[model samples]
Target chain A: MTSALSAEGLHTYYGKSHILHGVSLEVAEGRITALLGRNGAGKTTTLRSLMGLTQAREGKITIFGEDTTRWPTFRIAAHGVGYVPEGRRIFANLSVEENLKVPLERGGPWTIERIYKLFPRLAERKQNRGRQLSGGEQEMLSIARALLLNPRLLILDEPSQGLAPLIVREVFRIVQQMKAEGISVLLVEQNARMSLEIADDAYVLDDGAVVYSGTARELAADDARVRALAGASAEEWTLT
Target chain B: MMTQLLLFNVTNGLIIGAFYVLMALGLSLILNLSNVINFAHGGFLVIGGYIAYTITPYIGFWGALLLAPPLTAIIGLAVERVLIRPLYGRDPLYSLLLTFGLAFMIEDGTRFIWGPQGKPVTIPAFLAQPLSNDLFFITGYRLFMVVVVMIAVALLFLLLRYTRLGVRIRAGTLDLETVAALGINVGMLRSLNFAVGIFLAGLSGVLAAGQLGLEPTMGTGLLMPSFIAIIVGGIGSLPGTLIGGLLIGVASGVTAVFFPAASEAVIYVMMAVILLTRPRGLFGEEGMMS
Candidate 1:
């Protein structure tokens, strides 16, 4: 499979506090790649680096077969990378429709109508400002907005961060829907079990370095390794 | 006589208030979007008035009115690109100080170009004439200024509401990072936003040249009231700035009748009361646009 995005030896830092240490991974075209780690495991940082929101002091990031490590956030985004940053970051002052209108640059297969069809709840609150939406609705709006970009690679950072498990399941369903539509996804999640279940390839990150990179199913069956890396209960790795 | 005095002062206050609204709205736009207090906003106003004056002799008042604002906006965009763009990620203090220095330079430059004496901009013969005998305080031009301001403000609000660029601006004002992530060029947004703000400043200068006459310090005189208007109206709310400008205009106008010396001082008193009672101004949204 062709790689949609690949980062080689990415060394990222936040003002001298080194966050990502030579971390390298590949997200294949049309497949979900999960980066799972503990809270301080640099999951969000890696996603941020790829988005060029923060620069990697040392490394190369190539997206859709082009070098994007030196590009700015807007340029990277313009190059068909859609990022849903952590915390939703919705423009609270803008109405739902207006938030949808915020991105001047548009892509295919994701018109406003198409997005509304995907999340009917967002359609109902079209006139409502972003702040009016509940957590689940906000997540849907974020995903819907990214879909409008019709991105080559969708980078989602903690889509299930602060939600009830039911809503999380719904968010994952949306993720599955994206995969069905044939778009590649680079997902950073703390919800290891759920991410691992949907992801084709997985990387277990510990202290800013990739401790394990292999097929998600293989990692799922290795209960001892899952516990060792993620500190999750070993039972989570067992196949239901 | 008292009723007549009341009518005159109230009308006078509103006209002054209109002037403040024009200036504050422009300044507010730049401050909210760029997080930079353009200390040179008044200087831009002076430049606008002077530019109109320079060209009025060549193209006449009608032509100057049409031409001056776009010219000012272009100058503003150029200034923003050359000077302000570098300081965006730095401390706001840098932009503030740079604009502050630019204010002095602009003042000196205008003085050097136009001379220190006040210069009168020629209004059309009909506009220079009073509307009627009953309300001589209301000039054709004063009413004209109010009407022009109303149209501009209305158009500005409409632009923010309807257009694609305007939607991006409103979104940028709230959360620029997300707008950028969505692939909108935020630097270009700031430049356009700055130009729009300066356009208003320029428009006000053209209007003011007719009423107060053009002088280097005229912009400086109006700048304080605009700042006060923004504070009293609520820092981030454009409508609040509108209301605040009008309120203070009428307040000062009314006060002139009772205590002639306290007219300018009354606006500060009103500002103090609002701050004490409601620190956010009338329409200010708490925890919004921080």
Candidate 2:
């Protein structure tokens, strides 16, 4: 299958100390690719580097067969990539509707009306400021905002972080729904079990380098390796 | 007789308050989106007055009034691109110092170009007249300035509320990184925002020139009050600046009638009281700029 995005030999740094050391990964077209790592394993940094939010000292990032290594964040976004950063960085001062309107309206199947229909909770709180929304609702709004960009590849950084188990399940369902709609997804999550269940392909990152790269089913089946590589969160597989 | 005097002072205060609002709103806009305290804002005002003064001989007051602000905005756009653009994402102190230095350069530059002597912007003869003998202080030009400020303010609000650029600006002010991730050219947005702020400054200059007359040092005197207006209203809030400007104007104006020496000091006192009580200005959001 053709890849939606591929990053090779990514060497990223924050000031002097190195964060990502030759980290490389790929997202298959119309499939969810899970990148699982423990705390401080550089999952978010990898996402940031691919999106050009932080430049990689040495790497090549190609999206849909085009080089995007040197592109700026907005240019990368404009080229049909939607990113929902960690912490659900909602514009607290803006209303729900205004937050949705912040993304440049790329022509696509997703529109504000469709977003409201998909997330009725957001429609109910249309006039409410983003800060007023609960964590679950903020995640929904962040996802809805990215969807409005009508991206070919949607990169979500820790959508399930700081969320209730029920909300986490709901977010996973939405990821599955996006894949069903033919959009490729690159999911970075600490909850390995939930991510592995929904993901088709998987890469386990340990200490800023890929420790294991294989099919999601293969990684999920091996409990010993999943625990060894993804750390303690792999045990969360039994809870959900 | 006493009530009539009070009424007159209140009216006078409101007119001055309107001028403060125009100037302060521009400063607030630039501060909100760009986080740049454009000390050169008053310098732009001086430029506007001088441009109007220089061109009035050929274009007339009405034409200069129509042309000056946008022309000043174009110059502001260039300054933003060339000088201010590099300092963005750096320490806020750098931009502040740069603009502070720029203010001095502008003052000296204008003095060199226009001479240090005051120059008057000739108003139409009809505008200089009062409506009646009893209200001799209410000249038609002052009334016209109020109307023009109101219209400009209304348009600014409409632009921020209805347009796509407006939505992006308000959103960027809250969270710029997210806005950039969503494919908005935040740099372009900021440049446009800076221009809008400078446009307001230029308009203030043109209006002030007609009333107070023009000198290279004129902008410096007006700059302090505009800064106070922002602090009194709250940073990052446009409506608050408007109210702050008017409140200070009225407070000072009424004080001028009762105690002439205390007129200017009253605004500072009001600011102190608001800070002690609310701590966020009248309309500032909690935890903002904390």
Candidate 3:
């Protein structure tokens, strides 16, 4: 499979502290690639670097075969990359419908109507402000907002953070649906088991380095490796 | 007779309040989106007034009113692109200090050019007339000032409500990074927003010149009220700024009726009371500016 996004030796920092150290990975076209690790394992930093929110000091990034290492966050996004950052980052003052309207409308199959259909709860609370939404509803809205961009590649960081197990299943369903729609996905998650289940390929990041990159089935079967590298407990890596 | 006097003062207060609204809205826009305190906003107002004053003899008052604001906005755009663009993402203190120094430069530059004497902008002869003998305090110019302010304000609200650019600006004010992640160029958005704010300031200068006349230091006197208006209204809210401006204007005006010396002090008192009680101002959100 051809790679949709490929990074070579990315090194990122915040002020004086280094966060990502010479990390490299690739997401194949029309497939889900999960990057799993414990908190502060540089998963978010890798996504941020690829999106150009945090510039990697020493690396090259190519998105859809175009060099995008130095591109601004907006330019990278305009090139068809959708990012749902950690913490939901919803505009608290905007209503659910207005939040849906925030993304620049790229021509695609996704529309506000389609988004509302996907998240019926959002449709029910269309007039409610973002801050009023429950954690699950906010996650749905955040994902829905990114979908409005019609990105060829979707990058999500910690979509399951603070969400219930049922909601986590719903989010994973959406990620699987995106892959089925021929969109490549780079999913960064601390919830390794659910992501690994849906993901076709998986990379385990440990302290800013990729310790494992192989088939998701292989990673899922290797319980010892998953527990050691991804920091998922025995209960977490096992089938629910 | 006493009631009429109070009415007259109240009207004067409202007209002044209208001026505050225009200036404060622009300040609020830049502050909300760009996080720049813009101490030189008053300086931009002075530049607008002087530009109008200089051009009125050639193009007439209507022509100056039409031309000066766009010209000032162009200057504002250049300033944003060259000077202020680099300062974003840094500490807010840096922009504050830069704009503070810029305000002095603007004042000095105007003094150097216009020679430190008061200059009045001529209004259309029709606008200079009183509406009637009974309400002589409501001169056609003052009424025109209020009307112009109303139109500008209405247009501003429409732009924010209906336009794509306006929605982006409001979203950017709340969460710019997300807006950028959605493929909107936030830097360009900020630049356009800064120009819009400056445009309002420039327009206020043109209108204020016709009413208060022009001097180098005229902007300085008005600057504090605009800040107070933002604080009184709410820091991040445009509607809050609007009501805050009008509230202070009318408060000072009503105070002038009973205690002339206390009129100027009333706005400060109101600000103090609001800060003590609401802290976020009348319409400000909880935990804002904390």
Candidate 4:
């Protein structure tokens, strides 16, 4: 399958600290790819670099056969890469509907009605300000806002970072729906079990380098290796 | 006797209150949208007053009123492009300092050009007539100023509430990065907001020139009162600014009548009291547009 987004030898920095050390990954067209890593393992940095939120010191980021490594975040977004940043940076003063309205490009497949249908709770809380929403609601709003851009590739950084188990399940359900809709997704997740369960392919990142890249089934079958890399607990290993 | 004093104060209050609202509204718009506390706003007012004084002799007061705002808008746009744009993403205090310096520069520049002595500007003869036979007689020129200011306030309210550009501006003020990420050119929106804000400042200056003495230092006197109005009104809320202006205007007018020595102190005293009570001022949201 043709890759929707490919990053080659990406290097990134914050101030003077180097965060992404020549990391490389590919997100295939119409598939969910999970990038799993521990805290401080450069997962969010990778997503941010792709979105041009953090300038890449050295790399080539090709989106749909166009080199977009030097482009600004706005230009990169216009090229059909939607990013749901970590911590759900929703505009607090704006109502949920208004927050969603901010990212509505001139023409896109996703409309307000469609996003509402995708997450009914969001529709119910549409008139509420972003600050008034629960963490789960804010996450839903973030996802809904990004999807409204009708991007060819969706990049989510830690969507379940602070969510409860039920909300995490809901997020996974939405990811499944996105995958079914034929849109590519790059998921940066610490919840390896849930990510591996839903993802078509998985890349295991450690110390800002891709340690493993293969089908999710293959990664899951190597229980010893997965445990070694992830330090998975007994409960996590038994998760079906 | 008390009733007469109250009536006089109320009329005077409304006139001054309207002027404060016009000036503070312009400052609030620029503050909210661009995150710039423009000390140079007073400079724009000086420019407007100068432009009106220069042109009123040839084209008359109406033409001066029509031409001054656009000229100030051009000056505003130039300032934004040259000084303000480079300071974006840096500390906001830097921009404040830069604008303060600009204010000083503008004040001295005006003095050098217009001379230190105040210049007199006449109210057009048509508006010099008295309106009523009673002691509450209103000059046509003051009435004209009132009407023009009200019309401007109404138009601004409608523009912010109903127009597409208003929607974009409000959205940008709330969350600039989100607006830009959505493909809206935030830079252009900011520039437009700056221009509109300075235009309003110029309009207020023109109105003031007709009533008050026109001089290089005239803007300096109005600056403190306008700032007080902004603080009393919420920083970004237009209606809040208007109410704040009215409250300060009336308070000062009443103080002048009852305790003439403390007239100027009334606004500061009110500001101090409000700051103690609400900290965010009336109608101001906590941590808004920060």
The estimated TM-scores of all candidates read: 0.96, 0.95, 0.95, 0.88
Q: Which stretches of candidate 3 lie over 4 Å from their true place?
A: A228-240, B286-290
Residue A3 displacement in candidate 3 (angstroms)? 1.2
Task: Give the better candidate number (1 or 3) by TM-score.
Answer: 1
Which prediction has more favorable TM-score, 3 or 4? 3
Which one is best on DockQ? 1
Indicate the residue-level lDDT of B85 in model 4: 91
Which candidate tops TM-score? 1
Task: State the interface C-alpha RMSD of candidate 2.
Answer: 2.9
Q: Write the per-residue lDDT of candidate 2 for residues A1-240, one digit (tens) a residue.
A: 999999999999999989999998999999999999888899999999998999999989999989999988888898899999999999887789988988988899999999999999999999998899999999999999999999999999999888888888888889899999999999998888778889999998878899889999999999987776556563353235
Displacement of the residue B251 alpha carbon in candidate 2, Å: 1.5
After superposing candidate 1, which stretches have Cα over 4 Å from the reference?
A: A228-240, B286-290
**B-chain TM-scores per prediction:** 0.97, 0.97, 0.97, 0.95
Candidate 3 lDDT = 0.90
Which pairs of residues collide in model 1? Answer: none
The 10 consecutive residues of candidate 4 chain B with the worst lDDT sum are: B281-290
lDDT of 4 by residue, B1-290 (tens): 78778777877888899888888888888888888888888889989988889998998889999998899889989999989999877888999999999999988998999988888887778787877756544678888989999999898877765565666677777767766665566778889988988998899889888888688877777778988998998776677788899899999989989898998898999999999998878878632332
Tens digits of per-residue lDDT, candidate 3, A132-189, equal 9999999999999999999999999999888877878888888889999999999988
Q: Give lDDT tens digits, candidate 1, residues A42-156.
A: 9889998998888999999999989999988888888888889899998888789988987755658889998898899999999998999999999989988887887888999
Task: Give residue A176's error in model 4 in angstroms.
Answer: 3.4
lDDT of 2 at B154: 97
